[model samples]
Target: MSPLSALKISLPLAALLLPLSSTLASPPLVDPPAVPIAYSLEEFRSAVRSGGPGKDGIPAIDNPRFQSAEQADGFLDDEDIVIGIYRHGEARAYPQRILVWHEIVNDEFAGEPVSITYCPLTGTALGFERGDTELGVSGKLVNSNLVMYDRATDSEWPQILGVAIDGPLSGKGLEEFRVFWTTWGQWKARHPDTEVLTDQTGYVRNYRRDPYGSYRPLRGYYHPDSRRLFPVMTDDERYPPKSMVLGVRTADGAIAIDKDALREEEVVDVSLNGSQYTVVHDPDLDTGWVFHNPDDIEIEASNLTFNAEGVSGSGLENLEAVNAFEAMWFAWAAFYPETAVYEGGEAL
Candidate 1:
């Protein structure tokens, strides 16, 4: 059995060997983002609770391996969900099946270090620039979201907030990038050269099995109406707890666009702190793109393409896009209780 597998079968012995905290010091590797935090640093630290796995229990894939799209087809079904990333001219797909077992992947894009993070409980996948340090699962949870720690300083960061609540880097946020939550088939069709993460993730696991639930049929924990597995800072009853939403956070505040409504309307515009933002649906990827439209550009969507001020293109190619990710409604509301909700092509 592998080392991690050995630990799994011997949890009592493993728990005795692992340390609860780290005392090493290192420079911050991430730059803070301009986003709103609903709670004070202390409040966030106090809200953290053990997620049962313990530190590094659900190991992060530090040195990930990958296979080509054609090779990936041997194991993955067309409907299997994937977190797609296309950056610095490189396209890669991190399969949800693989990530469901390991929550973070320390990766490199065009030589720049980064981390692909996912919180299965909150249904969120986000990318962050990691610089020289690697992020690992802290085996903790806040608002039912994953909490990560940097190996360098052991700072605790709730995945949704992306800011450190404790340790040397407390109150600092990580620079984020957009991660497209798409299907294996959709991603392969769009980027044929993409590399899919392989199951050779150092730690042995049944990559085919998802502990929480399945996303294909949205049953069990992923069902739209299912209750959260853990307690949160706060709750909202306006929408079902597990409903999917495209969440965007900015310096002004946070906003959540209903994914189903965005699909129907194609284009929805909203104002955050007097700044206009346009959200357009990309049918090919089945995702939403949020654009900071301060100048109020008129963007029209047709089929699989978008036209913004006479510049037409596929996806958000012609327009600048902001960092946005798919998250559960309850998780978003818990982190940003005052966040504005947009549904039915209008602000609710």
Candidate 2:
């Protein structure tokens, strides 16, 4: 028999003999539900037109290995970027050096299943709860963001929106957990006891180098001037296409706070569709967070802390928290066309 045919036949036999975890290990290929047209065929084709590699082309790290902070010191550089997640007292860091190859890391933190996703193209790192389902890279890009597929229902979820735009779970959104996008130095300093994801992932990949580019001396697609690799559905020029912004979505509407603007102003209070919100930047960590400002609290930037409760100060009480993420201008604008941009003094 031909090697291809023999391998194909052997796969089923191997699956029958081995456990499901070993046989159908990859989430993308495991128990995919029947395909259903969730959006207009034309729209789906438009999304497909902004093509990427086939399924599993950029593999998802299903089973990951981790190391202690002391062990991670040998490999991680101070300037290296990492997505830090802290849940229920457990902290872990997923380095960009590794995530560039595996766009998704199916991991568990504090007994809760979480999918840590990084799209090098868009420079976005997000976390979502997998619940009873598993998520994998569909090897697709919509608006330059990674399109993930759920194993249980075969629904397509765009990383930026965290909502299923296609398939069985169309219109459904996954619950998100906050992830800190910061430098290794900052993360390690904050969480000294953190566990770091090691290069011991089952897949054979070059974990040291990033295919997109380096963030230290930014080059390749990550360069400040680098143009987008794919076309977006729409474009806006309020800020540079590559400008990084802290974007927040609420039931009323969405807003994008320019990172540079926030760095200058430190704190921005804006109203989105009559609901007030505050965006505060942390210079030490080079990170930001948004919080609901129902009382129109007068924020003191120097004393501000973007904590989970809200932007807290010495005298001010904690406010309600709002979900926000840092994303490139073009990517955020493409997904949320009506999004308002926040300049330094006032939201523009």
Candidate 3:
């Protein structure tokens, strides 16, 4: 694996052009992982919004929290990002003594108070937002996979991908060894007659590794709900129209394909949420627009590119690489290369 390390691990968007400060850190954990569900940022944005909470308050990151860690930018440049604040509906674990030296923070979790920035090196998690300018030359290094993002629009969602635990007990504070390794993963799926006690030396064989979520495991955003849902395309094979909501528009530059079957006052002068868009329908590369709100999918085309060439990121067709626990579904070949959808049981 050395064609420049296979093009630096096949450019996963070149890990978003690095420089949030040089990145490449990990070293902490002699015991970390113990707040299994205590949240309170409006229930972490109503549990990442499958929609359900919000009584008021909790969602801040107005600036100057971009990682100097809780505040101590003495040099080794701070940036840990990957925080949580969710209260009930489960999701509470900060144990590496607050992810060791405060990595990154925008805050809030599960009850749906979103933004969880964490990038352990290309493992990717632009899921939340709040701040930063990058690294190198002039000696700068912010790098904070200490997660927490999206304070209303920088879009963030990376939880655990790189730097699982970096260094000889980096700062020590393993809350009862991360709540006994997450109650032993909810006691091995609600106790399959329980047994795995593992000769306890602060038991660290497989770590917390997703105590719930049925089985998801771990990666960037923690993918699993069909990779975060969204990929409905067709033009006529047997049905040709399932639709959950897919739109596309761009005036003068010519590229308008809204068609959610058409209707929004018959498309007269359509304007959806402050315009400036780029929504290319990828009907079948396994799955594409399920980003209910990647800040409302925009790309005012200044060459906002994404020619998946042969395609991937796991919209699942032939498939080759997709590790955020897979989320994609682009198929587009049932027959509509230009247009065709009658479905009234055949009409020549």
Candidate 4:
């Protein structure tokens, strides 16, 4: 089927040379609401009609995006970043202004050579297979974001702002795992504590040290606050996101979370102070996101518990995915504080 896999899925140059960047004001096209999630063409041809995972071979590229500093976007480039498109049959649409300006791409579809991703720090758009090699596409970039490999669970993932790098080496790929559950619920409302990976790859993506994006916090990726995921693989096993981040108890008359399967989610900066209840930790690992705060007694229970007095329960989990909001938004006000109120759009 290689004719470039029968092409046809082009929609930007900004939407055919500028007309859909909200008519042209051009700095705010993150409408975000595709989140109800739907993919028919016979459920995306019954999720790739089993032509793959039989593991024949054809992957190659491995550049990048979404390790989350705001959900990912190192402004990568592999040119015209289309990546995968064989028409409604192998459908995969990832365009957040070309993933906020090229953070990753990988390429090919239909002949079945996928790897479409985006990461606006966590606005996620995931897909896999770009390794084992046949010049199919990892079209090879890494320093340029958008890599992600899942060679029959050999597992390798990355993307900076053409999202998808959701915690714990995410390599499930059933109909591309509903596009990684539609960018992992926008990477859990923007990395709400980023953690799913444990030790993925690419020299740990840049391996940890957070000057708050001032450079030095790239490390074995995914830990926005313990929603931790970081496995790009090569025997470099830093795994975790097969599952587990669900540990919430929240307090104040009662506020427990984590039911699973992703219950119609979309929890942006939910706050209520005057009682010092500043809560926003869907997975905000030291500001990776889901913010909002007023300051008082917000007891979101999970793991990283740190306090001085009156109120000491800040450890929420349940992402194991999302995009951050901006150069880490002052670490959600110095470590997972709050402000992520999505009306923006797209979870479908």
Using lDDT as the measure, the top candidate is: 1
What would the per-residue lDDT of candidate 4 be over residues 1-348, giving only the tens digit for each residue?
A: 122432453654425633332232211112232121122223222222121212212222243322432333333222212222223343333433333333334455445444554433333344444433311223232222233433333233333222222222332222232232223234333333332221122222333322213112223333333332121211111222221122111121111122232232323233222212223332322222222233323333443343211113343332222222222221111111222222223111
User: Which residue runs does candidate 3 get wrong by more than 4 Å?
Assistant: 1-208, 215-270, 274-278, 283-285, 289-348
Worst 10 residues of 4 by lDDT: 247-256
Predicted structure 2: lDDT: 0.76
Off by over 4 Å in 1: 1-32, 303-320
Using lDDT as the measure, name the better of candidate 1 and candidate 2.
1
- lDDT-wise, the better of 2 and 4 is 2
| Candidate 1 global CA lDDT score | 0.84
Query: How would you encode candidate 3's per-residue C-alpha lDDT over 1-348 as one tens digit per residue?
Result: 112333665465566645432343322222333212122223322333211111111111222122212222221111212222222333332322222222233333232222333222212222322123211011111121122222222222213211112223222212110011122222223222322211122212332332212222333323322232222222223322222122221111111233332222111122233332222222222122211122333322232233323222322222221111111111111111222221122211
Off by over 4 Å in 2: 1-45, 305-311, 314-318
In candidate 2, where is summed lDDT lowest over 10 consecutive residues? 28-37
Writing each residue's lDDT as its tens digit, candidate 1 over 1-348 gives 234567576777667645532333443445554788899988888888899987888888988999999999998998999999988888999999999888999999999888999999999999987776788999999999999988777788888998888998888888888888999998888888999999998776898899888987889899989888788888898999999899988886899998878889888888888888888787778888788887777776753452221124444455566788999999999999999999885676
| 1 versus 3: better TM-score goes to | 1
RMSD of 1: 4.8
Taking every candidate in turn, the Cα RMSD to the unseen true structure, in Å, is 4.8, 5.4, 22.5, 19.6
The prediction achieving the highest TM-score against the true structure is 1
